[model samples]
Target: MSSAFLPGFFLGFSLILAIGAQNAFVLRQGLRRQHVFWTCLTCALSDAVLIAVGVAGFGHLAMLAPWLDLAMRLGGAAFLICYGGLALRNAWRGGAALHAGGGDGSTLLATLLSVLTFTWLNPHVYLDTVVLIGSISAQYSDRLAFGLGAVCASFTFFFGLGYGARLLAPFFGRPRAWQVLDGLIGLTMWAIAAKLLVM
Candidate 1:
């Protein structure tokens, strides 16, 4: 990629690097050893879609529709709150993977739900990774360069997220670690929701 595109690539990287609902979910699934490969694939693929949409200049569709923005923000906030609440509940209960016994069937379906949880349900994912990144890329007007940067950024994020979480799994084996994770996730989600309400 050209040097001019580096800034946008980093822009995408910085926006996604922060701990958020999607990251948390990714971490949890990684810990559970549940649909690990496909989970990463879906995350990257979803990012690819969003990045393509932005670099292609179709993100204007999102900006033009007030209802779209509101619906996404509202839905995102609600999903965060509910998921966070679940995390908090799990935290209180303590210990490794919840409902492990139920992990018997349909790994593909479970993975798909996890993908949706990270992609569609998380409001911050769209605003930061999709809208913000797209808008920034649009400023350059060199669609080719902007797109290259966006795709690079997406690959970096999903790779780090999907595999990076695995790095943390060894640590989660200790007692109460899962609880701490859940508590942190709950807080992260609620904080994101609060930020959304103001926007």
Candidate 2:
């Protein structure tokens, strides 16, 4: 069980550490101190649910439907490209700032919706959390332990990212920092979109 748990933990952490739209959104919300807890909880819980589904053999079901995968890929690419464009525009206008105010004018409901959309709508999430992790878990005799380990990884990462963002608050205090961050985010979004389309 320990062996399975360790491998699962590392696999999960490595995948989640990759910079992507989901991480970008979480970081931004964390920096803004707006709904950070809810955002993190949503992300972690969502990952856990997906991982469980995957481990339960949903990956096989997904493989049985090529059309569904294609549709998800196309939709995900479109969303990413649009989001990237918005981020680029924000960077250009110098409007991407970490406001010290209570909220960024985004209501709690809106924030949660955005967070959920970012999580569920991305095809990469399915590929990573469902297909990849699920396939990998089959190698371990104690698959349940492995799945639990992966779930723990999600909880650890999201909460850490959400709460730990404050440590960088001073650096992000500068307007230029926001500009650079948004610029990178825009590029990341575009890159991932291109990957999805090409793949």
Candidate 3:
């Protein structure tokens, strides 16, 4: 059980650590200090549910739905491209900064909705949390332990990122820092979108 848990933990962490739309949004909201706790909680809980479903063998159901893949890929690509464009526009505007006060602040409901979209609309999340992780868990006799480990990884990561972003507030105080961050985020979105299109 311990052995299964460790591998699941590391694998889950490695997968989530990669820079993507979900992580980018979480980090941005975290830095802004807007509903960080709820945002992180939603993300972590969503992952927990998906991970549980995967372990319960719903991954095979996902595999059977070839059309779902096409729909998700198209939707995800469009969403990423649109988001990337917005980020680039924000960068070009050159006045954005991470501050407690407003400069495009959103309500909690809106923020959570966006977070949900970023998490669920992105096909990669399904691929990673469901198909890949689920398929791998079959190899272990202690699949429940492995799934729990993955859930732990999700909680650790989302909470850490959401809360930890505050530490970078000082650096993000400058407009230039925001520009750089937004630019990088834009590039990441486009890159991922390209990958999705190609795949």
Candidate 4:
């Protein structure tokens, strides 16, 4: 269980560490010092809910159809590989950078709505939190521990990103920073995919 927890934590962190609209919004809010806590909490909780659904649903489904476990593993690995390739390609192209300025000055409610939209409406979130994470959790003997680890990672990352945005703003402004981040993300994704394949 303890072993599973650490893997879950690392995997969860790696998956969320990728750059996306949701993360960009959180970073912007953090930099602006606007509804930071609520924004982070909303994103974390949304991930928690989805993670729970995925872990539980997939576990049961795998139980009913034993072959599904292998199928999902293969599918998740394929997805991760494709995603990693894209990240690597982005890294090679090396021109992406965060633009933290020019916020719309939206109200708290509006901001919350926008973040929610970014979270719930994104298909990638479903793929990452639900299908991918869920499928991976099924491989662990202690699925609950794995799920908890993932949940904790989500909370830690969102709060950190939301509160640390100001600190990260300068660092993220450079295209080289984005390239390095993308490179690391690509490597991490491929590593996880390799592990899944070996399992």
lDDT of each: 0.72, 0.86, 0.87, 0.77
Q: Write the per-residue lDDT of candidate 4 for residues 25-70, one digit (tens) a residue.
A: 6766886567899999999999999888888865344356667556
Error of 1 at 192 (Å): 1.5
Best to worst by TM-score, what's the order? 3, 2, 1, 4
Q: Candidate 3: TM-score?
A: 0.94
Best by TM-score: 3
lDDT of 2 by residue, 86-169 (tens): 878767777434443234678889888878878887888998989999999988888888888999999999999988988888
Error of 4 at 20 (Å): 0.3
Give the top-scoring candidate (lDDT): 3
Residue 65, candidate 2: alpha-carbon lDDT: 84
Candidate 2: stretches off by over 4 Å:
95-102
Q: Which candidate, 3 or 4, would have the higher lDDT against the true structure?
A: 3
TM-score versus the correct structure, for each prediction: 0.84, 0.93, 0.94, 0.63
Clashing pairs in 1: none
Over 1-199, each residue of candidate 3 has an lDDT whose tens digit, in order, gives 5789988898899999988999998898887788889999999998988888888888989767789998988898998999999999888887734443243668899989988988998888988898888989999999999999999999999999989988888888888888888899999999999999999
lDDT of 1 at 2: 67
Tell me how candidate 2 scores on lDDT: 0.86
